[model samples]
Target chain A: MSEIACVECGAEIRLDEDVIQNEILPCPDCGVELEVMSLDPVQLALAPEVEEDWGE
Target chain B: MTRVAMVITRVRAEEKMLLEVFRQRGTDPELIRDEELVINPSVIDPRWDEFDIVLQRSLSTSRGLYLLELFDAWGVPTVNSLRTASICSDKFKTSLALAKAGVPQPEVRIAFTPQSALEAVTELGYPAVLKPMIGSWGRLLAKVSDADAAEAVLEHRQTLGNYPYHVHFVQSYVEKPRGRDIRAFVVAGETICAIYRSSSHWVTNTARGASVEQCPVTAELQDLCRRASEAVGGGVLAMDVFETEGGFVLNEINHTMEFRNSIEPTGVDIAGRIVDYALALAAQLERGEGE
Candidate 1:
């Protein structure tokens, strides 16, 4: 498991060791959107609200 | 009991949906990443035999074509086929095939130099579209309305210096019906569902804030789509069409199509259909019915 503090409430959230970058999750404590910023050290940050549109 | 090789460079929402549908049906495909793969040219990897068919969904155009070509050379069956991917990835190639197939498309001109491009723009008149020969999702496409705009756009592309960017693919910008366009999803030469991308912008792609609405699959559409698919060798394809005063015009064909927004609007289980198609192709190959 990997550990990262939630940006919203500072609540520590445990993630799977193999979590990939750009994987999205919600902070359980504060409900803030969390995004996997990097995988090397398992960084986390408040995720930008995504409109989510990709090209064809 | 058909095995599948799901070639995915990234797990986008569309890929995830396909995976979820496959898992539900108890036939989870092996996810293969090109990044993690090391290839020895002309040598088949033992790992390649585990799957019967390869369904490619790579994001990059260059990577998708190379992988398809490599897999074809190795004699592994692939969805969309090697011929389809190579031709559809290049706008100029697509135009030639569409023309040969007697399909109606907007006027297009290909130029290798900036001077020729400028001349092509003059013949095409103002407000022609200048697009990269190889691209998707409407990136780097410009509408050239005047000589200055044409010169500037062509100059910028030359400055970009990428080989693909220099091959100018210019098309006459047909006025879409009420600023809307249709994208029909075809599976195995059959038209599955059609969706109208409604937007005020000239490019009515779903990625450009276009709202989706279900379009009834008329017989004309069925015939047009099937012809478009067969033009580039039969396989799964997405047909983008436009409506002008002259009627429907085929815009482009996509090999690795995205359909995240189409599901809710069309109410068609696209992922499930794709999984079923992949499995069927695998079965055919196992029975020595495939190339």
Candidate 2:
């Protein structure tokens, strides 16, 4: 496991060992949804907003 | 070895669960990002042939439909075939299929212009719903309680919305007891499990912040789901049903369903079931039985 700063709250957030690319997780501090953009460097970005045509 | 392709836009919780289930089953399906894909219709790409079957899981309905159609044209089998996705992606098309199949659904009317749509909504009476021809997650749904509200919504659609939004699909609003509706997950023509999404808001989609609870799959629900699935050309589907004074009526049929919030409440491994269905389909196609 590794810790990353929450982009929204500037608080440290823990990530699981098995987190995969594009996986979505909520920041424990601010609760903003973040997406795992990459794994090698452990990049996190805010999840994309839902589009008009997005659904299932 | 059965090769499967799980197509997706972004790896949401549902996709993550599906990947985990596939790994647990010793079958590591290839993850195909829809955005990175480039298909040359003039030339056949051998990369696509590597997978026996493609699982259409893109969150974008248009992307999913286009991908499914392309895969079908290439003679590649896909879960929820192109025909199913085509119908499910459009609300009007879904209503027609359900009506033809004798499946119970809410009364709906299609209109081309905003004026006609307002008239249609008026005919359906107050508390009617105006939905986009193609959309999901209960987005852009207007519950018109009066003529003023209907007119306002129609004007907004005509002025600001896109081409699809102008083509109004109006339906009679069915009152749900306690603002709750049922979502039944159907896999391979079988109703595997169901959940009740309750919300104080009129739109009860889980994505809209609704709470979920397990809903028992009764014989009535099972039969309804079976007929609905068959109506849409059969595959993995999610049926939204509303309980009314008359009985249960299907609200919509979803082609690429999300089941992350359903596993715990329903006690069903929805992702596992989906993976199993896809793998079975891949094996069958590989054996030439699907042809």
Candidate 3:
């Protein structure tokens, strides 16, 4: 597992090796949803909010 | 080996489960991010031809429909065909298809302007539902109990500035038993499993915090699901059904369905079933026996 600081609260967030791009994870401390933007260098960003057209 | 491509906007739980299922079945499926995908209609991308079949799983209905159309034009097989996507993406189109196929569904009326929409809602009677022409997850669904609520909703939608919002699609709200409705999963012309999404709220979509439990697939349900699937050009579909004193009526059909919350309750491997269906479709296409 690789550890990365939460973009919101700077809390340590451990990511599994199998995490895929665009996967959403919740911040353990602040409860904000984070998106794995990239996996190579472990980039993270706030997840996109639900849009009107975003649904199955 | 069948080269399968799963198109998506974000890697949601459903997509992850599907990818794992594909791997477990010994096929490393390609994940095509629809947001980053660029297609040159003038020049064919060789990468597109590499996949034997594509699974249309994009979260955006418009994106999924357009991509399905493009894939169809390229002679690439897709799990849910372009015909299905087009019909299911628009509630009005879906209602027409279902009505023509003699599928039992809620009474619906369509109007262009807010004034006419109020008339349509009035015709459907008070407590009618106002829905966007193209939407899912039960978003923007309003159950107008009276003329006051109807006017407010219609006015709000008119000001939203979106054409779809302006074009009103109204339906008679069916009262459910125990505040629950059935969501049946159909794969490749078969009703694989079903679940009851129960909630105190009128919109009982699981996305809206509805609790779920396995719903037994009765013969009536199976028949209705099969007919509904056929009406919308079948593939992998989720049909929402409403139970009333008369019987069950289809609410809507989702072309790209979400099934993550349904697996445990139904005791059915929905992702696995979908992957198997895609592989079978690939094999059929490979043998030159598919459309």
Question: Which candidate achieves the best lDDT against the true structure?
Answer: 3
Instruction: Tell me the tens digit of each residue's lDDT in model 1 across A7-47.
Output: 78999999876466655677889988787777887888876
Ranking by DockQ: 2, 3, 1
Note the DockQ of each predicted structure: 0.22, 0.85, 0.83
Model 2 fnat value: 0.86
Which ten-residue region of model 3 chain B has the weakest summed lDDT?
B37-46
* Residue range B1-291, candidate 2, lDDT tens digits: 677788999988888888888889787778888888877887767888777878888988888988887888888899879999999999999999999999999989999998899889888898999999998888899999999999999999999998988899999999899999999999987999999999999999998899999999999999999999999888999999999888789999999998889999999989989989988888877777872
Better model by DockQ, 1 or 3?
Answer: 3
Clashes in model 3: which pairs? Answer: none
Please identify model 2 stretches exceeding 4 Å from their true place. Answer: none
lDDT of 3 by residue, A1-56 (tens): 99999999999999987899999898999999999999989999999988778888
Interface Cα RMSD in Å, per prediction: 5.5, 0.8, 0.9
Residues A1-56 of candidate 2 have per-residue lDDT tens digits of 99888777888988989798888899987889998889999989999998889999
Task: Tell me the deviation in Å of residue B266 in model 1.
Answer: 0.6
**Structure candidate 1, residue pairs in collision:** A55-B137
- Model 1 spans with C-alpha error above 4 angstroms: A1-55
Give the TM-score, chain B only, in order for the candidates: 0.97, 0.98, 0.98
- Candidate 1, residues B49-120, lDDT tens digits: the string is 566788898766667778888888888889879899889988999999999999999999999998999999
Per-candidate clashes, comma-separated: 1, 0, 0
For the predicted complex of model 1, DockQ is 0.22
Candidate 3, residues B149-213, lDDT tens digits: the string is 99999999988758878899999989999999999999976899999999999899998999999
